[model samples]
Target: MNDGLAAVLAALVGLVGAVGGAAIGGMAATRGARVGAETAARATARQVQDQAAVDHMHWLRGQRLQAYQDLLAAYDAYSDAVKAVEQWASREAGDAGRRPGEYVQRVEAFLRAHMVIRLVGPVEARTMSAVLWEALQTHAFKLQDWALLVERRSGDETIAGAREELAPARAAMVDAHDVFLSEATRVVGTPMGN
Candidate 1:
């Protein structure tokens, strides 16, 4: 009976050892799986963030392109209007009535185009764009004043004075356009029209 009791005690010890080993191994596996899952979650989150940044940059590029296009269009329209008004002033007094509203429409178109610049232009480009707009506005005002004087059949000296007033504004507009183009190229590659 003592030998039987010893044998049973030995078997019981073996069973306890096996159970403890299995519990420890299972805990180790569970901990490893938890760490692996956490790693995967972090990787997935980083990928998603990277993708969002790429998408945002693409959208911003498109906006910049459109804004640049609009600004160029505005500049062209304004420039043509100024030329037209100058031509009208040079024309015979009777021919001046043919397109009295054309210059005004062009100025309005230019003002409308500025809205796009405000919406999508980056800070550097925006500053240049503002300078361009102010110069164009000054040119437009001087052109309008000159047109009025022309309609009144004012002397050549008065008309020449108005024309002279436009020179500085034109120079400023050209300088601003050049700066804006340079900044835009830095930001979005060469401009479409160029």
Candidate 2:
């Protein structure tokens, strides 16, 4: 071949190689940048999700604490109620007989004590649920029926009636507490479940 034509063909081949190399490099860079961007976005999304979960848990804990404080106030009010009932019974029912008005006071005291003491078990159950709420849903409801038992033991057959009584207040409190915890637990553990 003539030198001129050979030189022209060599130049054309070099130019084509340069263009192909640049295109390959550009494609690689695009692919790498896309992967890096996706990775960063995933990390950011996960961080945000984790932070939101923490904030929600803090709010729920505050709610649980408020419930507990209300329960404590209820207990204090019920204590006052017991004292008032006793005094009233003694004054209103006192009489000399096989069972004087004092007997009514005794009965009232027994009922009050019964109601107050039953609170102990429900409080314990509620506390347990709160402590474990972030972990498991099933555990939070393991004692679902226990709330009814607590009411029955306090002498209320109907659920609403139990709420009217003091012991049933604690039982209902525990039930509410458990419900909140169970919801949280279900949300938290769902990913872990499957």
Candidate 3:
């Protein structure tokens, strides 16, 4: 073979080998980059999931706490109504003849049925709190009926008589307080009695 031809052939063989080696190195680099990307994606997904779980738990806890607070406030109002009833009963039993107000019965029923009355607020009425609240309101209304009965009595109705009518309202209010315990339970994703 001619020297020039042999030299050209050798050069071509070296070029082919160099190109082959470069291609293998490129494939290795691509494989390493793919593994790194997959690992990073998995880590990011895990962090997002953990954060979401934490946020959801916090929201649930808040709802439960608020429910208890609302129920407690309702109970406090009911207790106040009961105290009024005790005072009324005492006054009626005493010899002093202080006449009660005509609307006294209204006040008494409001106190007795306080739970149902207090629940009448738009937001609370819409909630699970509404059931007991409606019952209390109804109880208070019934006390008004009692007052009407007294009004139609053959004997002269004194202010004290009207005031005494309020006694039923006051009792209903106390019952409303009792029922609030159940409403609060509903807020926590549990049954009221539970």
Candidate 4:
């Protein structure tokens, strides 16, 4: 009777030990899996955030490029209008009439473009654009005044003298245009936040 009782007791102890070991092993595996899943989730979130930042930077670069192209085109149109007006001024009585409205429209287009640059800029380019616009406006006004004087025969300054007087303003506008191009190009070429 004592031997049978001892065998039964030993069997019960072995069963409990096996069950306890399995439970501990299962708990450890669950904890390890949870930790791994959390790490993966964090890594995925970080990757998404980094990708969004890159996309935003690319979009901003494109916007700036478009703004610059528009501004340059508008400026060219304004310059052409100024030339047209000057040519009209030079012609004698029997020719086509002047289109002052066209000049005003071109100026408005250029100003709109300049305003866009002011909205999206690297400050230096914006400042140069402003200086360029001011110089151009001054030159255009001087040309208009000269044309008026010529039409009315009120001023003694000849066309040659008018050209000489405009030379400095033209030079300043050219310089400003060059500097704006340089600064804008540098800004576009550099990486974000640099």
Candidate 5:
């Protein structure tokens, strides 16, 4: 009877040891799985963040390109209109001069483009654009005045004086355009046509 009782006691002790070992192993496995899941979530979050940054950069580049194109088109249109006015001023007094109203559309287009520049352009680019626009406006006003004088058969000296004033304004506009282009290239890389 004593030997039988000792064997039972030993068996019970072994059973408890097995149960404790199983519980410890189960806990270890659960902890490992939790750590793995956390690592995967972190990796996924990092990838998402990286992808968003890339998309934002692409969008910004496109905006800069569009702004540059709009500004160029506006400047070209305004310059052409100014040239037309100059041509009209050079014509004979008896010739029918172009009405100032004819150039209003081009001026409005330029202003709209200038607003776009303000919206999307870097600070330096915006400043340059404003300078160029101011110069263009000065020349446009002078040309308009000259056109009026030409239509009224004003003296040659007065027309010549207005024409002389346009020279510096044109030069300033050209210089501002160059500076704006340089700033754009620096910000957005080389544009089409250099």
Candidate 6:
């Protein structure tokens, strides 16, 4: 071959090698950028999911707190209603009208609150709530029966016997209330911590 022809062929070979190297580098850069983009996208999605889970936990904690507060408040109302009924029963028959409706309303409120506790519970709290609710109901019914006997102008001995029967029920209710409170406190962690 001529020396000039040999030089031309070598130049062509070198140019082809340079073009191929450029193409390979360009493809590698594009692949790296795509992988980087995919990685960033996955990280962002994971962060969003973690944030959502935290938000849900906060919301659930708030709900449980609210339910506990409501149930406690309802108990207060029911107790007040019972007191009112007892007061009416102790007075002269005509001094104050019967408060059966008020007592029933308070009991209904308590029941509704209890239902919320059952719904938002962590099992342990729910069990305690059930015990407390049963005690409350038993005491309320006994008190109602005694009040009715008083309204009927029952003998002193009969009324005293009925009143005496309330002691055990009242004690049970008090004990149940304490247990329920402790369980509720345990289950309902601090707002910031939960």
- Regions of candidate 6 where Cα sits further than 4 Å from its true position: 94-96, 190-194
Q: Estimate each model's TM-score.
A: 0.85, 0.49, 0.50, 0.81, 0.84, 0.88
For model 5, the superposed segments whose C-alpha errors exceed 4 Å read: 1-7, 100-102, 190-194
CA lDDT, every model vs. true structure: 0.79, 0.47, 0.54, 0.78, 0.79, 0.85
Per-residue lDDT of model 3, residues 1-194, tens digit only: 99999999999998888899899988999998999999999999999999988776665556455545655554455445534443543443334243234334444443444444343322442343455555555544554454444444424456456556566666665565565555554545543212
Per-residue CA lDDT of candidate 2, range 42-77, in tens? 999999999998887666555544444443444344
lDDT of 5 by residue, 34-106 (tens): 9999999999999999999878777767887788888888888878877777677666777755554556687
Q: What's model 4's TM-score?
A: 0.81
Residue 185 error, candidate 3, Å: 5.2
Which pairs clash (backbone N, Cα, C closer than 3 Å) in model 6?
none
Alpha-carbon deviation at 45 in model 6, angstroms: 1.4
CA RMSD, predictions in order: 3.4, 13.8, 7.6, 2.9, 3.3, 2.1
Tens digit per residue, CA lDDT, model 6, 133-162: 999999988988888788887888898899
Candidate with the larger TM-score of 3 and 4: 4
Number of the top-ranking candidate, with TM-score as the measure: 6
Q: Which candidate should be chosen as best, given lDDT against the real structure? A: 6
CA deviation > 4 Å runs, candidate 1: 1-3, 190-194
- Segments of candidate 3 deviating more than 4 angstroms: 1-15, 31-35, 89-128, 143-194
Better of 4 and 5 by TM-score: 5
- Between prediction 2 and prediction 5, the one with superior lDDT is 5
Global CA lDDT computed for model 4: 0.78
Model 4 lDDT, residue 159, Cα: 57
Shift in Å, residue 135, candidate 6: 1.0
